[model samples]
Target: MAEPRHTRLRRRTLVGSAAWAVPVLVTANAVPAVASSMKTDLAVDVVDPPYDLDHWRPKDEVPVYRGPRGHRIAARGSLPPSIRITNVGRLTAVDPSGSVEIIIRDYGNDRASSAPGRLKAGTTNPSVMWTDTTNQSGAKYKYTCRGELRPGQSIDIPLRYFVNPPFLHAEFNVLVAAWVEDQQEGDYDDNSLRIGHVPWISVF
Candidate 1:
């Protein structure tokens, strides 16, 4: 028996539709693979403020009025602390163009304090007072940079903070936390680093 003209036309239409569907399915599956391969993996590591110190003694000790005994005292002065961040990733990490933001937090329970200041990368100044949002858990500061952080590339930031009267106590602790922004992180655990229970002392 010969096939009818309408049946033959329907078969040709189905064949044409199937031919286009094959490429669409294949493309859908291939796009995710290509995107996954291009993803940028970034890791941030804090390279300053040594963690294993038996004790971080004050550079200078000043006696305050006897209000509370055994107050972990920071000299009534300012300390210049150096913070270092490095990109430990296989690909380059680029911050949003124009400015790079770095946030530092004090996770210690005693009291909240942070000094915010802008310093050029690789430069240190003792006069700059690092200030932070009052009573906030963390302080964020932005800087101008090239924004391209290649693997293993590191930048050092200099910061300064005044040793106010209230921060002097025997158990006073100055915990420092640091992180970078604008990178596709592989492990979020390594994106930020914290050093806690640092002895609150003055380094003038």
Candidate 2:
């Protein structure tokens, strides 16, 4: 049976519309999938230990000294440790304005307590103070960058502190960590660096 001219014209129009709608629907459904796959890659790398174990130990064998008030005083040791944090990922990491946080933990012998240290921020010649001592083992540290850590770039923070001589020869563990305060990234396993078994000597 022969269809009317207007009817045939309308049928062709509907067919063309349906053909164009298929790809549009398919693309619309795929958009969520693509967006879900998009993720922020944030990673950190600790470059190296700034000072050796000998740097913490006293150069001479003497460890104790008599104070002015007849009290036993332990020898003083200084640590100027440098910590480097590098972004080893593809995407850039960002934090809120003045919200990036860095933490350092020093696990030393029980006989001696390690004091909080001051930190200088930079990559080569760091001189700006950016850390505050929070406790015996931790500090609230800041990085020099304005809030963005780009891929393959690094920031160095130098720490200076004094430690009392231990009761005997003991080992100290230093751990450094950093992160963005309100970042949405879930994985933080790589944000910390551990340099264990740093030796401290106390000679009686």
Candidate 3:
């Protein structure tokens, strides 16, 4: 079932396509609907993971990457997972074109860079945050691509994910973050997104 908007809490009032966030929340969502306010100028999002880009990419229903054959992502975590990208800004996200940098975070590390600034817990729904993958811990990897992806445009990341392991069950927190250089995102929020995983497992 979808969650009620009233139950959803954001650091700031989201304008543009961010106004409607999916029910995907962590324990932190129970806080007040408004806080001091967090903001980001960064213009792209990982619309949804787990649903796999090739199979289902949501836009009108909700919102929810790339690569050659323009941009691609390495599947990591408890994943064979793929992420979708969307340009949610009024202006185009580009270095004169579309330049996107992505970092795949490990299951539970919630650092503000490359990882979610806020800790979220759930499955399938994508969470977005603002981060720089400068110093990340655990099994994480980074990917980037340069092209022209206009505002409101989306691209699905190709499936090429891998996970390093010791042992585990089927469930996992599949986390990822994206950003563009030269543009400063307003808050340490929403340039990154994460979701829990279903059965399919790949271990090293």
Candidate 4:
């Protein structure tokens, strides 16, 4: 039988200490609804990871490495699971160009470095963070990427994701932040979007 959503949320409420009422609200949703106040200049969309970019590469809004277009891609937490990017901005723009790819680099023993793991199936501990990496395809556009957000503008990035490990449980939530920036580092005018992943509950 499928685990009750409330049961799953209870676990997060306990571990995440999210909020007293948040779990009740989340449990109430038969479908997730975007929060009204959280909307920013960028439209964020979360979707299941893609299998291959061959189909995604043909989109019209696919972000090029360099263009006059400026974007802020930000996500938080270190995890090893699945997450969907949803559009939260008022802008109805879509990432037809397929220019962005999420990359996770294990920070390893270096506590000072950034943790870039994806969402996981089970177990939440030692919270970590993820900073966007510039084009994994070695493409960097030279356009004047600014932090200016117009209505209905956003970057929809699809990730090809999977978790391989000492399989014990199915998934867990990894906290993360995101931004629309030209490169992985430095200060871009755009503010980082901090989002927390709901536990990627166990499937096995």
Candidate 5:
């Protein structure tokens, strides 16, 4: 005898649902493995970014050191804003070979409407700053790190972020963030220690 029509329908539905669910389960299970692959022995991280300028423009112009051969590019290129970074890795960075770099972005405050790093209505308790690489204001803080950084060693990376039209007295939130793009980091987590300021002080 043929199976009842309703019973056949229910079996078919369950089979189809199980087939669809199998792929989701596999994808979910693979996430941990993929994340673990990103692990590396090299470790370094940002410590803090201090901003004392109020109603000042970050020095955007690239300047040169007055060397014997006229103005020459210093070993460490210069940009205005500087943030401190420390080597938190188990081993010191490879000398004269490995390098540490940092970039800077000013994602505006609670009022900001940008997609990646927009803050919620109120409070800055757990600030989540986003890095908008396409943003013109986003710039690499250049410095020549040419030596060994024993664990807990810190260096200030000079950075600069400027708005073309200018933000003379604008009020907004600022997230000064740095990221480890090389093998120095075990995980790809963008960390920041905000140097908090009054709402009006974030003006660029």
Candidate 6:
């Protein structure tokens, strides 16, 4: 026997509805896949820069001499050093306002104990304070310095301090770093530049 006309119409309607539903479900699942593909493309475009050499300017000849224990021999280079820093805030005289920090390391990768060897802000610290590098093998030194720059104010750190280097074959580099200070306790800020190498020379 033939089926009723009403039943035939119901069957047709159900089949059409399922066909449309399949496309909608497929499209819904495809959205996440499309977003994932776009994310991967964006990640590939991100690239980090290599090292810069010009930032680490080389000196002609750095002098090597000796000062008495607990005493520092200061030497001022003829030319001043220039550095560009970022991530630092205003150059006010307040906590976290922005200041300068200088560190010296000996050729043997050890901190040198030179009395009165410090960089004084707003002026020459010790006006040529020196370090005794005499008789010290591999007696090299590196200066790691950083400063916070306030708006419209720039600080120029002259290559003024010198050490009485001990070894003639000693080699060293100077790195200038800068960053904003974190107000939180125990959490330091991230450095901006790992300046190229500043070759240390002797003026014997």
Best by TM-score: 1
What tens digits encode model 3's per-residue C-alpha lDDT throughout 1-204?
Answer: 322111112324233343422222223255434321321124334444333346442111211111111123222233223445555443444422122233332323322223322121112222222122332342233444345445556555443332223223232333444333423334332344434332323323
Provide TM-scores for the models: 0.42, 0.40, 0.37, 0.24, 0.35, 0.29
- Per-model lDDT: 0.34, 0.36, 0.33, 0.25, 0.30, 0.27
Error of 4 at 100 (Å): 9.8
RMSD of each: 22.1, 23.3, 14.3, 17.4, 20.2, 26.5
lDDT of 2 by residue, 9-78 (tens): 1112111121111111123365867544443343334434333355553222212232212235443322
By TM-score, the candidates rank as 1, 2, 3, 5, 6, 4
Candidate 6 residue runs with Cα over 4 Å from true position:
1-80, 83-151, 170-172, 178-190, 195-204
Model 2 misplacement above 4 A: 1-39, 50-80, 94-129, 136-138, 161-184, 196-204
TM-score of 4: 0.24
Model 6, 75-107: lDDT tens per residue? 322122432222232222122222233333333
**Candidate 5: residue 136 lDDT (0-100):** 34
Quality of model 6 by C-alpha lDDT: 0.27
After aligning candidate 6 to the native by TM-score, how far in Å is the CA of 126 from where it should be? 8.9
Q: Any idea what lDDT model 3 has?
A: 0.33
RMSD of 3: 14.3
Q: Which of candidates 3 and 6 reaches a greater TM-score?
A: 3
| Top lDDT prediction, candidate number | 2
Q: Considering TM-score, which of the candidate structures 1 and 2 is the better prediction for this target?
A: 1
Steric clash count of candidate 2: 0
The residue ranges of model 4 lying beyond 4 angstroms of the native Cα positions read 1-152, 169-171, 182-189, 192-204
Candidate 1 per-residue C-alpha lDDT over 4-78 given as tens digits, one digit per residue, 9 for 90 to 100: 111101112111121111111113365767544543343334333322235543332223221222244334311
lDDT of 5 by residue, 117-187 (tens): 22111111122222222333322332335555554455554433333211232233334444433353223
Error of 3 at 111 (Å): 15
